[model samples]
Target: MARRFVTLDVFTTRRHAGNPLAVVLQAEGLDTEAMQAIAREFNLSETVFVLPPERPEHRAALRIFTPGTELPFAGHPTVGTAVWLALHDEAEGGGTEMLVLEEKVGAVACAVEVTGSHAGHAAFTLPRLPEAVGTAPAAGLLAPALGLDAGEIGFGAHRPGIFSAGVPFLCIPLASRAAVAHARPDMGRWQDALGASAAFVYSHETAEAGHHYHARMFAPTLGIAEDPATGSAVAAFAGAIIAHEPPGEGDHRFVIEQGYEMGRPSQIVLEMSVRGGALVSARIGGSAVVVSEGVLL
Candidate 1:
């Protein structure tokens, strides 16, 4: 039998914007090699394979795969898959209900509330605590690799660090929006500096959009020069910011805008809290749109 897949755009209010993901439903019999091959064929940032839930408490088993390898968890895939499943009636309680999914990382929970029959319409929330792996990249090597001058890097907020809710990314804060917009990595220097980090470089700009931040990410090692919008990176960024920001401030929440240079405008809401030297729960949420609904076969 031929396999089937559905493609959807995530983190945007319209189709063709946001990150694209392919969902392979009911992929119980497919092996790992086959899944990877299928993922490679799809060639999206990530693809999701839905399997039978091992335990009764879980909704469905979700496996996330990048073009290169399988990831323990990912933000867009989780959000897009939940919405897709609900639209197809595979998830519980129909379109208005919250969907709980099982993945390698842990049980993830999200809700898809439909606004209309329009292809690009749905609100998604990843209601789970983000866990940090506590691994960070060195600052010395990172500065030169991104073509960032010593003066362009801020002292407190610009410190190079690593953070992850699921996948670890090296978070770098630049001095200004101009610095972020003009940043182009020195491939040789980046490869040399972050070889051991296995992390991507992410930068941001302050925005007036309710939350005061804009963001961008680069992962040349993964064969992606830039990601249109990265939810995982946003979550990781939130973790690092909460830890680095000064005390005596109330909780901070921001909307991170990205993908302008790529022409696919994207938005991500990052929320976090830090207390007693430990960063508390970090959550990243975004809007998704179903650009197309067709079978891979």
Candidate 2:
């Protein structure tokens, strides 16, 4: 039987300006190999397979994948998959302010607010509470992997670290947005240095551009060289900040700007707070516009 899939460009307000994703609906019987094949066929950055919920309280079970491998959890796939379900009327809409989505990481709560006409898409928030895993990375090895000079990297007195809300990324601070924008992954070195230690290299600049930082992600491990907007990485970045940054003088919420270097121009909002010893209620959310929707066949 021929399977069907729908594609969308995520994170950007306009079409064709963000990361592209494919959603495979009615994917109940497909095995792992079949799913991977389907994802490769779409050839998008990521593809989501929607499955029936194991429990009645949850909305759906989402399986996320890049072209190369299946992921336990991902940022855009979670958001895009929810939107896809809402658009197809598989999940409820309009009546409820929040929806709970089950992924491999755990159950996540997504809040959707319809900001436009009923026929148009709505913006949603992902609960992105992430945790800091380690203190810092070896600058000697990491800087060159991102094609940057050691002086071009920023330690900010906090040091580079490993963080994750769902998926882990090594958050590296850069001296300038230009450095981040010019980043090209040195795959061989990155593989040798990172080597299952990190799934991606998230380079960021602090110069605000309608957001707290301009960022880019290079995951040769995942077959992606610079993701336009990384929801998971943004969430992890926020978590890392909360763990490292001094007590805020003001609000903690901020936006992440990414994809400009790649010409896609994407934005991700990272929302979180610190309570007790752990980072509580971390959410990574963003907007996505459907660029095109057609059957795979």
Candidate 3:
């Protein structure tokens, strides 16, 4: 069967920058195994298989996959797919559009801005808020896994922990921006220190002014060497952020800088709504551009 597919650079307006995603549009008849195989062939951070929505009213049902496995939900794919749909499948010319994407986690509500240029912005409130899934290994063990010294492992109130909105990641806070840039996965110790869990390393010092954070993500177990940008990690990091940063009751917006070192420099906008000193809701927003489109045989 022939299916249509488009590749997009997510979290950035540039064509070659940001975390890359491949979205298969005519994926109605592909099975789970076939989808996974296709994802491996594309070899991007994540690939989206768009299926018919169970509720015909919704936009589409998405099955996100890394080369190694399927994800209940993923950030880049959702953002990229939404923009693609708004510009192509659900075009309304030039206005904000509201749609729903059904993922294994649940329904995700998205708002996309239709624009004059190819770059369009999309934001989706997380279907599931982050929850503490488990404890993190000590700084000593974590440091060796990422080729960092124990001293560079943590700063301020931030230590290492595991959090998941839908996909789980080990949130590791480093001492400085320098420390974040110095990270290199020690493949020998990585698997033992963290089994099948991706690592999200971040620092307070950022590459861009006014940016709240700078981050890097590593997920070899999921067949990703390093991700240019990671929305799910940022979403999960919100749980850690609220615990450590502890913002007062209100809506807070933060710009996260990522992928600078990889040359794909990407930015992600994280919005958190708080009430009574507790987080109530959160959303991830970014822009994506279609780089190319072709038919998959």
Candidate 4:
């Protein structure tokens, strides 16, 4: 049987930008190996297999995969899949629709505002709060891994550390966006310097004036050399934010610009609510546009 799949560019409004995701609909019968094979075939950062919900109230159960392995949770796949379901699976006639998707990590709630088009804006609150897992390698070891000087490794109160919401990321703060754009993984040194850690490098400088931060991610271990827009990393990044740039007890929003160096300019909105000097809640929001859809033979 031919399976239906849709590809979307997540975290951006334009086509051929942001992170590309392939979503296979009605994927109940596909086993894990089959799904992994299909995801490798797609060769995107991540692929989503949407099946009937385990629970009646949920919209669907999603299985996310990279070329190399399965993932408990991922950001772009969840957002793009939710938007695709709201647009094609449901007929809400243009309003905000809520969907609860069962992922390996847990049930994730998504809000899709259907604004009369294939393109849409979707956001999901973090089901799990970010926690500091550990500290990163010293700047000396990290600089060579990222092809940067030790002095460029951090700025303000930010330093290299590990954080996780659903997935763990080695959050490294660079002094300026210039360092971010120039930074690339020296793969030979990468494995030895940061084992089992996907590097999520960021800077306080913005490419576009309105955006508040800039970022790029590399995870060869997960078969992603570089990712244009990474929502999970951003979600985990809340920990890095709270650790370094402490915000007052209120809602704070930051628009992060990514993929510009890749010419796929992506914007992701991260909103965090702080209460009693602790992060109470957080949400990741972004826009995605349909690029193409096809049937798998």
Candidate 5:
């Protein structure tokens, strides 16, 4: 059987930028091993296999996979898949719609905005709230892991820490964009400091004027040395921002610029509502462009 697939550049309005995701539609028969092999073959940051929703109310069930392993839930894959499905439905007379998807973590609600037939924006509430998993290694240990000096390891009250929304990452705050841009993960040190978790590095300085911060992500353990855009990282980042840069009791929005160092500059919009000095809710939103489609025999 030949399965249909579509590729999209997620978290950016334009093509050839942002994170590239391959979504396999009509993926009814593929098993876990087959999906993993297909994900490895795509070699993008992530690949999504769309299957029939276990529940009739949901739009679809998503199986997200990195080159190395399957994920309970992921941001870009959800956003990209939602947008692609909306557009696909639009061609068949469906207009802008809200979709509920079944993921390993839970049901995810996504709002998709379709302009015409091709370009669209998608946003989704985090399936799980981010929580502090644990403390990270000291600056002395983390600096070498990311090829940075100890002095550049932190900014403000933000130090290295572990956080998870659905997936976990070792979040490191750099003193400047220079440190973030120059980062190169040392395999041995990375293994010691983060083990299986990926690294999400960020700094207050940004390349664009309207952006609040500059960021980068590295997941060599997952076969992704660097990612152009990472929605799941930003989802967990809401916790970090709330912890270190606590906003007054209200809603706050931030635009993060990432992937400039890799020449695939991307933007991610994060919205969080805070009340009683704690984060109440969070959402990740971005645009995606469909680039290609084909059938896999």
Candidate 6:
């Protein structure tokens, strides 16, 4: 059988600058093994298979897979898929539409902004709130793992910790952008320190003047040595920000710049609402461009 697929650059308005994703449409009969095989064949960070929604009202069901394994939920795939669907399925007029997509984690409600027939942006509220899953290894243990000194391992009130919205990541707060740029992962130490979780290293200093943070992600266990843009990581990062910054009640926003070191510059916008000194909700939004479409036989 031949499956129609679309390739998109997620989290960037331009092509070839953000994380690339392959979305297979009309994916009805493909089994789990076949889907995993297809994901491996794509060799991207993630591949999404679109199926009929189990619920009658939702837009579709998304099965997200990394090269090595399936994920319950992923950021770029959700954003890119929502934009692609909105552009192709909706009438060509500048307006916003709401879409519900079912994933393994839960149903995600996405607000898609359409600008034209082919260009659109999408944002989705996190289906699950991020929480600290566990504390990370001490700075002494994590320093060698990330090729950083113990002194460079943390920032004010932010240290190494594990957090998850739907997916878990070991969030490491570096001292500066220079440190984030200079750090390298030692696979041996990484295995010892992080074990099963991926590492999300970030700094308050950013490469872009307008951006609020700079970041890099390493997940060798998922066949991703480094990821250019990671929405799920940013989704979970809301918790870390709330813990450290503790914004006043009401809505706040930040732009995160990532992937500059790898040459693929990408931007992710994070919005959060707080009340009573607690984070009430959060959303991840970004622009995506449909680069190409092909039939996979």
Give TM per candidate: 0.86, 0.88, 0.97, 0.97, 0.98, 0.97
Query: Judged by lDDT against the true structure, how good is candidate 2?
Result: 0.70
Candidate 1 lands at a TM-score of 0.86
lDDT of 5 at 146: 89
Candidates 3 and 5 compared by lDDT, better number: 3
The segments of candidate 1 whose C-alpha lies over 4 angstroms from its true place after superposition are: 90-96, 118-140, 196-204, 246-252, 273-279
What is the C-alpha lDDT profile of model 1 across 230-255, one tens digit per residue?
A: 87777666666665663333455677
Span of 10 residues, lowest total lDDT, candidate 5: 88-97
Q: What are the runs in model 4 whose C-alpha is more than 4 Å off?
A: 90-96
TM-score of 3: 0.97
- What lDDT tens digits, residue by residue, belong to model 6 across residues 111-185? 998765566899999999899898779899889988989999889898787889999988899999999998898
Task: Please give, for residues 234-279, the per-residue lDDT of candidate 2 as tens digits.
Answer: 7677766775664444335777887777778877776665566455
lDDT of each: 0.69, 0.70, 0.92, 0.91, 0.91, 0.92
Worst 10 residues of 3 by lDDT: 88-97
Cα RMSD (angstroms) for every candidate in the order listed = 3.1, 2.9, 1.3, 1.3, 0.9, 1.5
lDDT of 1 at 67: 75
Put down candidate 3 lDDT per residue, 180-236, tens digits, no spaces.
999999999998899888999999999989999999999999999999999999999
Per-model tally of clashing residue pairs: 0, 4, 0, 0, 0, 0
Supply the global lDDT for candidate 5: 0.91
Worst 10 residues of 1 by lDDT: 118-127
Off by over 4 Å in 5: none
lDDT of 4 by residue, 189-252 (tens): 9988998689999998988898889999989889998989999999989999999998999999
Query: What would the per-residue lDDT of candidate 5 be over residues 135-176, giving only the tens digit for each residue?
Result: 788889889988989999989998888889999988899999
